[model samples]
Target chain A: MADTVATPKAHGHVEHHDVDYLHDGSLLSWLTTVDHKKLGVMYLWSVLFMFFLGGVFALLVRLELFAPGKQFMDAETYNKVFTLHGAIMVFLFIIPSIPAALGNFVLPIMLGAKDVAFPRLNLASFWIYVVGALIAVTAMVTGGVDTGWTFYTPYSTTTDGSVALMTFAAFVLGFSSILTGVNFIATVHKLRAPGMGWFRMPLFIWGMYSTAIIQVLATPVLAITLLLLIMERTFGVGVFDPKLGGDPVLFQHFFWFYSHPAVYIMILPGMAIISEVVPTMSQKTFFGYKATAFSSVAIAIVSFVVWGHHMFTSGQSQLAGAIFSFLTFLVGIPSAIKVFNWITTMYKGSISLQAPMLYALMFLILFGIGGLTGLFLGAMSVDIHLHDTYFVVAHFHYVMMGSTAIAFLAGLHYWWPKMFGRMYNESAARVSAVLVFIGFNTTFLPQFLLGSRGMPRRYYNYLPEFQFLHQVSTVGSWILGLGFVIMAGYLFASLRKKMDAPANPWHGRSLEWQIPSPPITHNFHEVPVVTTEPYDYYRPFEPSVKGHH
Target chain B: MWLFLATEILMFGGLFVGYGLMQSVYPEAWIAGHHHLDRIMGAINTVFLLCSSFTMVMAVHYASTNNKGKTIMNLLLTLGFAGGFLVIKYFEYAHKFHDGLLPGRFFSYHGGGPAEQAMFFGFYFCMTGLHGIHVLIGMILISWITLRTMKGEFSSAYYTPVDLVGLYWHLVDLIWIYLFPLLYLVN
Candidate 1:
């Protein structure tokens, strides 16, 4: 690719660090690295490790739930399995997957900045997350938490397991989350390139900017909540312990206040990826660019109010419930607008079916269902019936797993070449995308029916009536696992191949793609003076292309 | 720095929300609980924290002006004020513990409605205890900045960390500003 030879500096593509980011390839470098790209890669690997670890726990959950009478593990082990699964997935994987991992890698380049405003703090955030994960592992080894990831009181307080360590782990992780948020916010505010005005930036920046706001503002609430919960369990503080006159329901309000906005925290970055992918794959500029950008901020603001909807069936006031239900509907508008905009961008454009495009399309369908189902739960009366059922489980899985996890995968596939300077098997990627979509639907879609048909979540055993759906869902989990295994195979296989990746493999209009496949240590030779809008596809993207993507 | 402070406010903001809800639920219990706290000591600690904030502001001011000597002096004053605040907190917690106002199941008070009183005391200890932890963290931060100031690492052209740390210290004081009223006083 000629772009690789369009040397911004005197050196051509021969500089090893220019095409790949392994640096000196020493343990010391990995340990003490402050480069945002290195930190982002570290975050990426750790989150993936956690994802598979959590996936194993999920498989065990599905295996146990395969038959109504408990196939293998006892009820106690079952409880611990599901709890560990939830805690691991939430804290270790999905929460940090997009924003901390992909955002850290791409946000700087997207804005044409050399690095985030606080590079040292970026390094510290990664270490803090590691420390927090270590604490959680210690808790697991000691006596794994079984109070559900929500850690609702009385059960959480009275549990003999390692609630204190686990909650403290979460509290520590909250600090990591906040530090990243603070760093991102500062970077967006102070580190944009000379000519990169706010609107001139890509949609991914807007999504990340909004996510950073929520991460900074909302994550701390979770920190304090967990701290109080930890204090409650360890010192027998009566805050969430009702036997000592504390309201457990009050704990619900506090938890969801953070956790709900946290839902957006999980999804918005995924939305950002979709926003980026649609423009590049469709070969068109973004539709409703301003609305799409502002919608992220709008979603962030509205997310806080809808948290009360999570507490609707938990003995909140009637007036409060009605208001929450109303506000919950309001939060959907921004998401609906984003979906509409993505489709509109694809409307008359020369859309191509690429690997990343396939995942983006899948995300559109899956996330649409996820958001629409949220409306069902948002309705007060419907939520009352489905509150603790598998329905709620399925609903959130649609949002969390179906959307966020899938989006993370999408972003991973989309940027894998740029990050590694290697291209995976395109056909294999497309097949994996299909398997993932089908397998995911097969796994979660049945659970929704089981939920509606009166299957309670967190059940160690169930009646024979719910067995068929459970079996179907269990089969779906295997297919889903197979999809991931195939994905891992091709991704790893791509690493060993000799074929080098083109810098602009996807013809992406973003700054990250315009540079070398794997960008240099400092992203640009000079901080790029941005003179064009992102996804300026109206301009001839490649007037002299060697070959089309 | 402002973004970080916003997080801190939201963090303590959550705790205050919890405190507010619990207080409203058990008004008489909260009323009964606040009495056990040493109001005069609380007032004094508040003054100490306020003075610390002022000193921190002065440290930033001096650092911005590139006056390393005055910056160090004001930082020392801020640390001294934080120390004074901790000393009063020590005595206050000591009095409560001495009077058997410990947390949860450890509460040995002979008062009626032990559960309700424990609930209030629970919030009291949690709120003040969390605040106390922040003060300790703030002191450590201040000491670090003090050493940095003495080492002449900061100047007018670049005092971002000093200015940021000052923002953090003010947030601590601001949280205490609310914590004092909510935990130490009631009509």
Candidate 2:
């Protein structure tokens, strides 16, 4: 009778203390915490650390190439430098930057749920990521891999360095990615709050949902491809060795199968963050929300078929090349639609130049350039000229660095208060955003020109004629690096001092905005019953009785 | 579990894609390569895996219904079939190793065009070796499930583990079914 009794406290207040909730004490509480919010913050910090690490590598590469002729390192070291830059940036940083951190943190909260469907599996995914990263860093310290991240055959199989270690590391990392994908899929399917229909979900969730599908479907191919590479190195399996009559080109097919859609994996979450931030800051609903959501799925599917474009110069069939080229062009349409939708959302709206909005606008302009140049690369004739040149490097950076990195910054500024229960310096953040935009263009735009002028990429040194552009690009990288440091310093400083951030600081219309700052362990005190669409700016909630600046 | 099995399919799918492309380019070499593989051993392994699948399904069924004795009995039969499959695979590999039909540059088969022959065996070794690893892992999982079932841990209401293990067993069987025609009965 005592256990079954439901009674108020002696003072007439509800006894909320004995719920056996989170806030339980111990180091293991964090180490073994299945709370999605905790895991999300963990992902955020870890990915940010990796981003800085990868940025350090990028700066090292730029310093070495600043005016060519081995400014700081020899060719062998340059190869290792760029290889490390690519491996860390792609595998460790960009892919997980927004999705693993922001998506994991906010998705369940947005849906008004307590945690992801599979919480222990979420912990496993994070640990697996940590282990994979350790293995990669270990390989880096021991002379490093030289075959580049693509790990094309023959070279990958025959490389004398730590290819086995690197490939196995990537192989292990793929499982981590797959597990995260699995968790997201299961959570999205089973864990929406009452009354949140498919259409009413925020566009960010739709973006993550589409990205999860790609992560689940395409990551397995990379897992298998890396395994084969491991087999080739460890057991002398001749699957990709040309000398043994094995077709090295087949390895390219397998690698690109996962690697191409992998680009979408890197960018879609960033695009999703932009979709969320742009409309909220602009004081308008997202224009064509359904079209934007569908485009995420559309890009995922179409990206898969266009992987063959990577192998156009690798001796694939003419028919295969033409089909892939055509598909590559077609895939750009969804990306274009997303850009147009974001711009339309901002057209004549109360467009504020906040830090998050600054980053979002930058994402649109840079991703537009990145996506359009991708069409040129998708064209057979143009690609033949720019296949392995700095042009390709410039094209991807616009997408990966310019677009994804900018979106990552936008999301960071957008959700910083929610995650940390504090507000950062808005003016400083906005200044960094502008600096990053200018520095990013100055760094990459020259590479595009150099690439068009016949400057091949992946080489340690280049022709003397390209020295001026390389120097300018290297200088811009320092400015970009300085911008990142200033931004990081501002964020870190904000955390040390307590600054009050309200529950709905942005005055945005999303489910996550309804929750407490830094959220209680069980997210919502009561499950919010959704009745309207996510971005209903026209219908504002009652003005706050007690507002704080 | 289905998703893990799907990953395995794609793993083998990569090899199959390679094999298909190579066979199209060099049909004669592929035919000669096929002649070198021991069809009898391949056929025996195929039958062994198929029987293992049947026994695994039976084990799952019994475990689901809480028939502990029947579940253990069926699992032992499945494990036995897996053992037989591995033994056949070992002998087949031993024969190839003894004939100097190794992979890559270590290959020393006296047959003409040793490079092409090496390519054939390269795929053969990678596919079968990877599959063998899967079989080994499946046996461990099956054994764990068998022990758990003996403790009456599964029932109709809580038989997801049994069902997942059964799905895994069927996938291993399906892979062998594809492997038999491609490796042993190649046209």
lDDT of 2 at A270: 91
Interface RMSD of each: 1.2, 2.0
* Model 1's DockQ score: 0.79
Error of 1 at A152 (Å): 1.3
Q: Which candidate is the best by lDDT?
A: 1
lDDT of 2 by residue, A1-549 (tens): 112112212322112542223344465778788888888888888998988888988898888887658676888888887888899889988888777889889999888789998899989988999999999999999879888888988988877889889888888888888888888878888899888888988999998998888888888889878877887787676777876667788888888899999999999999999999998888898899999989999998998899998887899889999999998889989988988899899887887677788888899899999998998799898899999999999999999999998898889888987787667777788778878888999999999999989999997877789999999999999889889988998999889865355555676777777655666778766777787778878676632111111
- Model-by-model DockQ, in order: 0.79, 0.57
Evaluated on CA atoms against the true complex, candidate 2 attains a DockQ of: 0.57
- Reference-based lDDT, residue A350, model 2: 83
Q: Against the true structure, whose DockQ is highest?
A: 1
lDDT, residue A332, model 2: 88
Worst lDDT run of 10 residues, candidate 1 chain B, spans B110-119
Clashing pairs in 2: none
Model 1: CA > 4 A from native: A1-19, A541-549, B111-115
